[model samples]
Target: MLYFIGLGLGDAKDITVKGLEIVKQCSRVYLEAYTSILTVGKDALEDYYGRELILADRDMVEQEADEILKGADVSDVAFLVVGDPFGATTHSDLVLRAVNAGIQYRVIHNASIMNAVGCCGLQLYNFGETVSIVFWTDTWRPESFYDKIKKNRDLGMHTLCLLDIKVKEQSMENLMRGRKIYEPPRFMTVSQAAEQLLEIVQNRRERGDDLAISEETICVGLARVGAEDQVILAGTLRQLASCDLGGPLHSMIVTGHLHPLEVDMLQIGCPGRNPCIKYSYQDG
Candidate 1:
């Protein structure tokens, strides 16, 4: 049997009881480290689980998956994922391969940021389509996610932006030279994502695209959610453009037309009880 386990957002103890049991029972355990990461490191997890984990980088999971899946017919194998197993499409594909190979599998689930994000006091049902904001590379800026946010905001629904994370990535120069070098892992913070969004809005507005979102729109910046020191702030896009949300693994929520309950909830969520003040374009 193959087990796909979700190690929840915070730490090693965050693993579900069932997942921990499976981890101990499995013959081989591979920790998938790329898509997203837990608050703690591998050694911490190993110390708790009492198992030496094999670190599966992008190359191992994407290219050499068969090796991980090998011997599954004879022994139980467990693949650990940072969030929910289905959070990344790659794990879904892994399950497909296991099924095709006639390997029985079970998913042990845990809390992912997708749902835990509601701890920010926003209504989960009020959130619309989730969009991923990626790192803007030189000469390769993409603004397509802006349209999704606009659509969500148009319908009076919130937008959850899952920031990008680059792990075990290789530079083009190194790749072309056939070198075995990789760049340090990077996780996009809420501030960086907001800066990129504001830039896109500014570019579109300069191009006379009146449909672009303005800088005064409300945005919520979150950092290290589900951790002990998680920080959440509600402010305008302009205000958040310069805020320092320390560390990686950040996410942002573009708010919608506010309900009284949501306003009350957010008032409690933000520090100093400052509820988001309403600002609409039509008022002018």
Candidate 2:
């Protein structure tokens, strides 16, 4: 049997009891290191799991997944994902492979930022299609995500922006040289995402295009969610661009049609809220 288990978005103890039992019994356990991350490091997880885990980078999971699936027919192999196994498409592909091979697989679920993001006081049902904001290179800037956010906003729904994370990425120079060298990992912060969003909006307006969103739109910046020191800041997009939430693993929400209850919740939840005053374009 092959077990795909989810490690919730926190420290080592976040693992479910069933997941821990499976981890201890499996002959091999591989931790999916990319896509998402926990607040703690590998050593911390190893100490709590009582099992040394093998780190599986993107290349291994994408190009060499069969290696991880080997020997699964005869023995139990465990694949540990940082969040719910299905949160990433790669894990879904893994499930298909196991099915084709006639190997039985079970998914052990846990909370990911997708749902856990509600801790900021936005109701879960109010969220629309989630958008992923990626790091834009000097020569490669994509703005399609802005359209999705506008669509959500027009429908009076919130937009959850999942920031990009680069891990074990290879530079073009090294790739052409056939070198295996990898660059350092980088996690996008809420400020960077907000800055990119602001630039996109500015570009649209400069082209004489009207936008549903603007600098004055209410936005929420979240960092290190599900952790003891998590930070949630509510303000305008302009305000969020300069605010520092600290550390990696940040997410942002472009709010729409806020209920009084949500405003109260956000104010109560935000330690730095100054009891944040909600702003809207209409206030102008």
Candidate 3:
């Protein structure tokens, strides 16, 4: 049997009881590391689980998945994923492969940022299509996600922006030389995301496109979510651009028409003496 288990957002202890049991029983356990990350390192997880975990990078999971799935039909194998197994489409593909190989698999669910984001008080039902904000380069700045944010704003729904995280990426120079060397991992911070969004907004304005969002648009920046040191700040896009949300794995919420209760809840994270004073229904 093949088990795809989800390790919830924090440390190794966040694994569900059932997931922990499965991990202990599995003959081989592989941890999928590229999609998202846990607050603790592999050593911490190994210590808690009392089992060593094989780190499965992108190449191993995407290119050599059969090796990981081999003999799963006869023996118990566990593939651990940060957040829920279904959060990323790659895991679904793995399941398909398991099925074709006549391997029976079970998925154990856990908390992911998609659902845990509501800790900031935004109603889950009010969220529209989620969009990803990628790292912008000198000549490769893509603003395709802006259209999705605009559509959500048009319908008075909030937009959840999943910031980009580049892990084990090859540098252009290395790729040109046909070298397999990888650059360091990079996790996009909230401030960087805000700066990129503001730049896009400026570009759109210069092009004479009346955008639904602006510099004064309300946004919620969350960092290290589900961790003990997690930080959530609520303010305008302009304010967030200058705000320092220490640590990696940040996410942003572009709010639309806010409810009175949401406004109250979000204000708790706002900086300054009078947080709620700046935000009013008339402002929206």
Name model 1 segments beyond 4 Å from true: 270-284
Per-residue CA lDDT of model 2 for 38-94, tens digit only, reads 999889999988889999988888888888889998999999998788898888888
lDDT order, best first, reads 3, 2, 1
Per-prediction backbone clash count: 0, 1, 0
Please, what is the TM-score per model?
0.93, 0.95, 0.95
lDDT of 3 by residue, 1-284 (tens): 99999998989988999999999999999999998998898999999999999999888999999989989999999999998898888888899999999999999999999999898888989999999999998889999989999999999999999999999999999989999999998999989999999999999999999888898899888887888878788888888898887878899999987988898888665222234324434344
Clashing pairs in 1: none
**Model 2: residues with Cα > 4 Å off, grouped in runs:** 270-284
> Over the stretch 62-117, how does candidate 1's per-residue lDDT look in tens digits?
88889889988789999999878888888878888888998888899988989998
For candidate 2, give the lDDT of residue 162.
98
Q: What lDDT does candidate 3 reach at residue 6? A: 94
Who is ahead in TM-score, 1 or 3? 3
lDDT of all predictions: 0.85, 0.88, 0.89
Worst 10 residues of 1 by lDDT: 275-284
